[model samples]
Target: ILHVTLTERRKEYEKAKERDAELRNLRDTAKLQEFFLQEIQLGELWLARGEHKKSIEHLTNAIAVCTDPNKLIEVLEDTLPPHVFEMLVHSIPYTLQV
Candidate 1:
């Protein structure tokens, strides 16, 4: 379900002008808030594109910079699929572990 949707959207986004613009705009922004959302969106894009490592990189960065728990939760919920979500869910504790 979500697999097909994200992959298809990835393809469409690859051809989308707005997607590129958003990517570029977000990357250029220096503010943490702006960068975090852009990074999350970019992570989704990368994940959809089957670039898991890149996706993780951006998603991790997003998680690090997020000041609002609600917004962070929203991105976590919306960006990840079952398998990816499961992996991330397990990794959360380790990520936070000192």
Candidate 2:
């Protein structure tokens, strides 16, 4: 009975560890999403205000953190003007974080 109890406790501890890790991942993902949205929104705001350089900077930051930049780029292509989109493409870092 003691051995069974120990085994059960060990299994429970392992399950708790896995749950903790998963929660941490979820929190990190949420934070990343918040940052990405903030950058994208700021970029759009600057772009609408005709601040090309500032817009590019924020948009570049957004792309840097984005997990799937190609998809984001496609969406941006549709959202931004051709010239602006071209500029953004050039501004992207060679080594993206994601």
Q: Which candidate is the best by lDDT?
A: 2
| lDDT tens readout by residue for model 1, 67-87 | 775477566777578667666
- Residue lDDT tens for model 2, 28-93: 999999999999999999999999889998998998889998898999999999999988988885
Best by TM-score: 2
Task: Give the Cα-based TM-score of candidate 2 against the true structure.
Answer: 0.83
Q: Against the true structure, candidate 2 has what lDDT?
A: 0.91
Give Cα-based local distance difference scores for all models: 0.73, 0.91
Model 1 earns a TM-score of: 0.52
